[model samples]
Target: MSDPHSTAPVPSPRRRVGRPAGRRAGDTTTRDRILDSARQHFARGSYSSTTIRAIAADADVNPALVIHYFGSKRDLFGATLRLPLHLRDQVSALIRTDPDDMGEHVVRLFLTAWRDQNVRTPLSAMIRSVFSDEGAADALGQFLATHLLGPLVAASRRDRPELRVSLAASHLAGLVIGRHILGVAPLARADIEQLVACVGPVIQHYLTGRLPAVPTE
Candidate 1:
């Protein structure tokens, strides 16, 4: 017979507590993988050529997941632009590099920076804006002088440093604008190594070579 009449305590039913409501585990890692894949695509081709399906395939995730994390292709591009935060440091380190070969280093760096669409878009936009906006021109000039040319010029210890820097800057600016922004044929499709070989020496002469004296008024 059961001791129902006896005063005995019985255990209540145990309820299982599920995980807290939020992102699933490994979601962050998946998002990062998608971002990396997007950067690779942007680096290899222009933004117009890179597609969500391609990025998803590269990331090895479903296309929906990429959209779920980054929203749209533009949004993904905006995210990739943030990846070059260390570029300034790379440029700064040139000051400590060998001045003899600095031109090659500089040309290589320039090509690398403009090779990707994420960084190239803003740079091209700023350059185009300079035609109509004096403020943009001034800002661009100041940036080029301070960040790009100033450091290399100081390191070269060449005569007429200002003129040398200007010449070198002009050559490099023209090259990038024609090859990338304007998409000039032959030059646009030229191998990066071929460009480095042909253009690097000209930059070297402008920055570190002896030049004829110009009579000043």
Candidate 2:
């Protein structure tokens, strides 16, 4: 409503600043980029050695963004792989079984579960990773110790439960490696019931038997 020719200062448009490089407008593809980078890093490297900062640099995003999106390194490792679902439920079921028959059930569960392609593929990958990489071995051992074997051992209520868990887990891991991965002749061709019968008692002994005293160094 003022004079048409009056001199007036015009407002400048607000400038956007401090956006991370390679982060596109609206940040649409950032998550996908991070995941893609994670897959690549995990494929070639051990889980322990692969850092969030490394993955972020590879993805062209900030490390904080990786944490924001995926939570943690372990979470990122899980994201990069295809694993079986309802695993905790299966473990829970195992925990609910008869204590004496638990060894047989545990062996049977491993043998039967491996028959499923969905379960076998990921498990095989994880086991293979363990065999090949010390870092991965540590990570997987910690995960199994913390998540799966910890509860199972607690249920046994046995003396030196930690050692019992270790022995039982080591036996089962060897069974998977020899029978499934390495293709050990008789073990590879052995029937599930046969192996279960042979291995089950040994596992039970490890879990519930009187272990020898630890030797002093």
Candidate 3:
């Protein structure tokens, strides 16, 4: 006979079989789910126009979950856009040692990056958004400035004594927009080697060569 005050052995707390409670663990499936949703929304249009609620709905999760996993929309976009290759490191190395052939490197980088199915599909959408929407342009500009340009400048500090990195960067940016994004004639059709051959000198000039002097009185 058990005493009236005696209690039966308590069952151990059962661990959840599926996704953990509160916050899902930082597992691949959760990340993939978030990324899938992000791609859907970002590919549709601009990052600014894509709401967290919409992303959550598409992902089939709570809105708070996105924030919990990715921190912010900007972070989510970055994650989605991040290529497998270490672009900053690669570009930095190219700018430092091959400043003379920066244009070829730029073209190669763009072509390679776009070749990747994951990067290309989303990047195409980003390019479209940049042209069609103001908010997208601003967001993309900020992202590029912070991630791409900033790193390139820092990397070239040793080699670019004159510090004209901006000019070089601008030239590369123009080429990318014209060739890949806009699909301009001739440039779009040109083979990689032809483009590299044509554009390499222009980039070299921007990097280290002196500019033409203006007429003076």
Candidate 4:
């Protein structure tokens, strides 16, 4: 008979304790997977209910890894919803310098960003994604607080910061969509200077001027 040890079957190799091979838990691929999972969960009406554990499961990562990559669910959502630009820095600069010209500067800055195909393309996608994905609305609202409305709010030394933020946000959103997205008559075709002249004051008012009083019932 063959030797007992030689005839015996070899034991299977033990799997490693760490994350499986091929991709690291903290790699870009893993991060993108988390974001993609978040986007899917948001689009599927599960945003409010989704958890870090769920997202990690979907991404085949550990919950600790999710926390490692994004501190919390809201932060994960923010990461997923972030635009492709350094919005805070750019807007903050306009808000800081040239108080008198800040409004026009803001308009010009917007027009300039939108004029670039690279900027417009990603921005369009982000806008559409933000507005259409209602599941992510709360997260989007939080993000807008910092990304779009934060600058105007920061620039203002006004009474109601809420009013300033809301007013500026509404006006800018309308301006962008009306001009670039919908291509609405005069706004769509109007010259950049004309837009700056017309819309600048409105934004300026929202930023630094007095707001209309709320009527008591």
**Most accurate candidate by TM-score:** 3
**lDDT agreement of model 4 with the native:** 0.69
Give the Cα-based TM-score of candidate 2 against the true structure. 0.66
Per-prediction backbone clash count: 0, 0, 0, 0
Candidate 2 lDDT tens digits, 20-69: 65564446588778877876776556565668989899887778888887
Candidate 2, number of clashes? 0
Error of 1 at 75 (Å): 25
Candidate 4: worst-modelled 10 consecutive residues by lDDT: 117-126
Q: Per-candidate TM vs. native? A: 0.57, 0.66, 0.70, 0.62
Model 1 local distance difference test score: 0.73
Write model 4 residue lDDT over 1-217, tens digit each, in one string. Answer: 6786786678999877964332665578878887787666654444555677777777777788788888887687777656446644677676668766777877777777676654554345445555656645555456556765665667666678877767776677778888876779888889999999998898888877877788899
Among residues 3 or more apart in sequence or in different chains, the pairs in candidate 1 whose N, CA or C atoms overlap within 3 Å are none
State the lDDT of candidate 3 residue by residue for 1-217, as single tens digits: 7688878887999886743323356766877887898998888877568888888877777778888888987778767776555776676676566555665676577566667778776666766777667655555555544555445545545454334456655566677678878889987888878877877777656655676665699
Model 3 stretches astray by more than 4 angstroms: 1-28, 86-89, 92-96, 158-170, 207-217
| Candidate closer to the true structure by TM-score (higher is better), 1 or 3 | 3
Model 2: lDDT to the true structure: 0.75
Off by over 4 Å in 4: 1-68, 71-77, 80-87, 115-122, 129-132, 136-140
Instruction: Report the C-alpha displacement of residue 176, candidate 4, in angstroms.
Output: 1.7
